[model samples]
Target chain A: MSGTINHGLAQLAAVDQGFFTDRSGGGCIQDNKLFCPGWVADNYDRYVHPTLQHLVLVGSAVAAGFLIAFALAIFAHRHRWLQTPFLAGTGILYTIPSISFFFLLLPITGRGALTAIIALTAFNLQIIFRNVTNGLRNVPANVTEAATGIGMTPSQVLWRVELPLALPEVIAGLRIATVSTVALATLAVFANGGGLGTEIVTGSNITFKTGIIVAGSIAVIMAILFDAVLLLIGKLLAPWKRKQALV
Target chain B: MIPLPALTLPTAAFGLFGDAFNFVFDGREAETGGVTVGGTSQVLDLAAKQLEVTLLALAVAILLAMPVGLWLGHRQKGEFLAVSAGNAGRAIPELALIALMAAAIGVGLVNLVVALAILGIPPILTNTYVGISQVDRASVEAARGMGMTETAIVRKVELPLAVPTIMGGVRTAAINIIATATIAPLAGILTLGDFIIARNVYGDAGVLAGAILVALMALALEGTLAGIQWAMTSKGLKLKRS
Candidate 1:
């Protein structure tokens, strides 16, 4: 136990201390060859791996969350006993603090990307499940009635009619969840998995390097690009709704 | 204005209560002098600051979004933009925005307010646009045909009618902003997140306390917004819903 604790402390120290102290150099515009800005640029790739890891962690969590949310929605929809308790439970889960949840599970999950992913996925499930439930529920009664009256099985009605109508909201929820998972994924850096947040943490530890600037810029660019792409996708998929809305 | 302060107080109170409760919880097992409550004051202070920041951002979003949303709604352009921009806004994670804001402005309340503004914008903007547009067209047509000016029709006919729906968006935006505002401490802001982050650094019972405090803060925001939604939509104009 002492060995494990020492190893964890040593690992944290390496990331927290080593990363900060190892800055490139200092110089003004024309006075010297190695400037902080140039150093930050030169080390861009150092950030990429952590960022990629963060992305993978988030991507996996979102994928898992969607599956769970979808299954739960279907189960809750069919099971009369599950609806209220499921909702109440998820709603409370929705309230759990991410830090508390992460720490509570840290001893078991052993920190790193796994803990972040688990916490994020669990938190995200609430929103996704709620959205799925509402999306499925909101299919016009007329359409469902027509499907049932035509003698379609329950499965056929769900796959054919309800799912299609629910697509807009479900897709919207997925988009939101994707963004959330991406953002929260950065917090994984605290667990030593590394991400843009590592840069922020490192930058704060070393006041001179402007790691903050570099990290912040990359985070902004990612967010803008992510938002723009999702907007494009939402528009393309929901052209019918968009046209109707415009009219 | 009266309603906002009245609405905000219980949240502030509960935030304090939650922080106190968490503090006791954190101190329970530890030796009397050794136990630290872990910046509960900072969290409370941050909650107040966050509430201030949220109100400021919401005020700005409401100001900008209402006019544009109302105009678009009047022009029947609410739906397209609502789906496109609102979806995109919702998709741009709050943390990403904070990081971006912190990058652009450096870390501080300014960055936090900007990040939250981004988070709070979609709901208010979408609701305003949708609410005004969703107003009964016949009512608008009849009012216009009766010689009401376009501006008057909007101010008098559309806004009042759209209030309930718009209020829904505002309520959602406020709650989202409040919840997200906690993340501000990641950037070194002295908010409730400080407690959470500090506990992360210390690994003490303070972590649980901080978490509970933050949750209660969230609940308080949730209830206040619900009340605001009720008050704004309620027909009889009662000060209290009951």
Candidate 2:
């Protein structure tokens, strides 16, 4: 136990003491040259674990947020009186800032992906909840009335009529939440939830431009990829909206 | 605002809430040495710096974004540009943006402000455009009919009507600016984030104190902006909404 603790201290010591500890081999690295493609190529494999961790962080948080917000939206839909309080609660969660949120959670949840996920998930609640509620509420009352006339129960009407109409907005909210979460998840390193941020914030200072560019590009790519996938899913679900767009 | 902070019971971060508050309001002993780290004045200075940068970056974003967003909105042009810009803007990682700006451009108040402003721009621009375009067409038409210029129509009719939405964007920008400013210490701006990031210097109490202060500052600024938004709304619009 002491060995592990000593090793952890040693690691932290090493991080603080050096700007570029492994810079001897490559001329590019030795000079601290910006955009060291050669060094990046050699060290590219280092990012694999952090990449996966980041993916899990962004993915699970968004998924959990959507579920909770969707349920809340449904409840608020049923009981109109619940809307204000729910909005205010989620708004407070959304307002706190992610770094502060992560550390604030440190004492309670302990560090790592769960704490990061909880914070990220809480942040997402407001965006998703607002969008989902608006989407549900925006359903033309006439359409629901027709569904009711067709012998549809309230739950059936909600699932078949209201949710389908709300698809575009819900998906739009997802895209925003997903993209922002991808960016925000980089800060998860502070909580010790590894992500692409491990590369950028490798030390007390970030003198290594190459590391940042590589990690940031991957993160941006991830955000775009997530966004595109969500967009395609929305398109598939709302085919009529697609057809309307084409005209 | 990018979805933001969360809170719960403070645990291993420090001894107790009282201790943390005391750490903020009175100098605290560091873990390694007998050195005193944080106190009321230090905390206040850091808070001021954070607020200054947040407002500065927000002002830069407003100045840069509002004209473009308002004009696009007034003309009903560049919907794709405005929308896609906001979407694309969301994708830029905050850490990456900060680290890269520091690495490439050199670190200082100017660079940090520029980096934070980059974040604030998108939401404000998109919202302003969205808000202005969303103003009732009839009102704008009536303004024009009453011998108003395009500028006057935009200022008098569209802006007043779109106040809530535009302010929503500004509010979003403010939240983002303040949040991002917490990491300004990474780029060498010693805001409240310095306490959080330099855990070695301040220890757990300092870190927790920093977190608490940052959270409170965010809430306070957000509340202030909410008030501004309310005050900016035309009384007619307020009553109509009520």
Candidate 3:
């Protein structure tokens, strides 16, 4: 019985020495361990702001891109001649990699969220615009003619009939754009437009694995959430299609 | 880190661009050693390194992704796998990918190749499957009726008909790989990105120069691939000239 008490006291001493304690107390950072669980738990608060910044960046860029691309698509839908130029313009922008696009904006906009957003918006143009145009084109001719026979104006037919049907493809484009932007926005660190990448790239130690893992995981989760939400929105917009599935 | 007096305006920016252009054509002096940093030869060498690394990765990806995509496509299986791969690929953060890979597995040429090849695979795989799936089923039936071997049918019919779509995937993969390669310097390989990444050594002009050159290279590569894809497409299959 006395020996058992002594052993318990010895184990307590080991805990006191910090062996049983969290590695966040310093040892993990010192050793540069691959993944310091304790260190991550302690340090995760630092990533919150950067994560928010990343969200705002993606939201603003995609919103602006959709508006611009949607307008262009509508206008081009009427004027067939505009299609080639619009496609060519957006195609060129899409071909330029986001990192290069970011830096190329530096001289013009300087480094900040504006530069990052503009660059990201430029990247979104092609994907969303193409889908919207294709969706508009793919609207069945009979549906339009039926709407016209019902005394609906051309403008009414487009807004009420064509745009609603095009929602599926538009949402698809948004999902692609949004997911890609979530991934691409990490490069906003280069523009000094803070994001999770700020944590991944410019920490006290950049190659620190735990920091990268934390940031990357958050970005990925954000992407998945965005993709799911967009998909749900698409289904909600097309309740008729959802009901069809029930049958 | 250099604090310039007043070069933020567009005019001043244009001047900087001019300096960047000069730096690429005629090398600028290094801060210490009085050596030239960027000129034609050095830029060309780094660009070449980027291309070499890109091609190596792309070749590996084609070898791995194509066969699997083609096989699955032939078997008409793994639709979920093929489709999800494209979305999942888009979701991977490029910066974190490189940083994490470098941190987790030590950086080298071979390791970099592995990183880029994996990045390039999904689009190639997805596109290959979609391309093969889109081939007219009747044509495959016709080939089979003629007693052509499975491999022969795949090679002679599906591949030829699917060239446009298949090449579209290659173009996407190539653009991605080449783009990612501009950041290869972080992993210890010297590429054109060194000029941009190492701003302290090369200054703003070199950085700007690096950005322009990388953009041009990516666009040029895309254009060349489009041309090659156009050539590879069979004449009878040329329905639309988009």
What DockQ do you compute for every candidate structure? Answer: 0.16, 0.43, 0.38
Lowest lDDT block of 10, candidate 2 chain A? A238-247
Off by over 4 Å in 2: A1-25, A243-247, B1-14
The candidate scoring highest on lDDT is 2
For candidate 3, the iRMS in Å is 5.5
Clashing pairs in 1: none
lDDT string for model 3 (A16-118, tens) is 6664255453666566677778777666677788988999999999999999999999999999899999998998888887888877877887778888888
Provide the lowest-lDDT 10-residue window in model 2 chain B. B1-10
Highest-scoring model, DockQ: 2
Model 1, span A1-247: residue lDDT tens = 9999999999999987766455442332133221257666546777786667666776778888889988999988888578778876766555554544564444345456666677778877877887788888878899999999999999999988888777667766776677666656666554554566676565334232255555645655665566567657767766655422110
Badly placed stretches (over 4 Å) of model 3 are A1-25, A203-205, A242-247, B1-7, B31-34, B240-242
**CAPRI verdict (incorrect, acceptable, medium, high) for model 1:** incorrect
Model 3 clash pairs are none
DockQ of 2: 0.43
Alpha-carbon local distance difference test for all models: 0.65, 0.87, 0.85
TM-score of chain A of each: 0.77, 0.88, 0.86
lDDT of 1 by residue, B19-62 (tens): 44666434333333465544545445666876787687777777
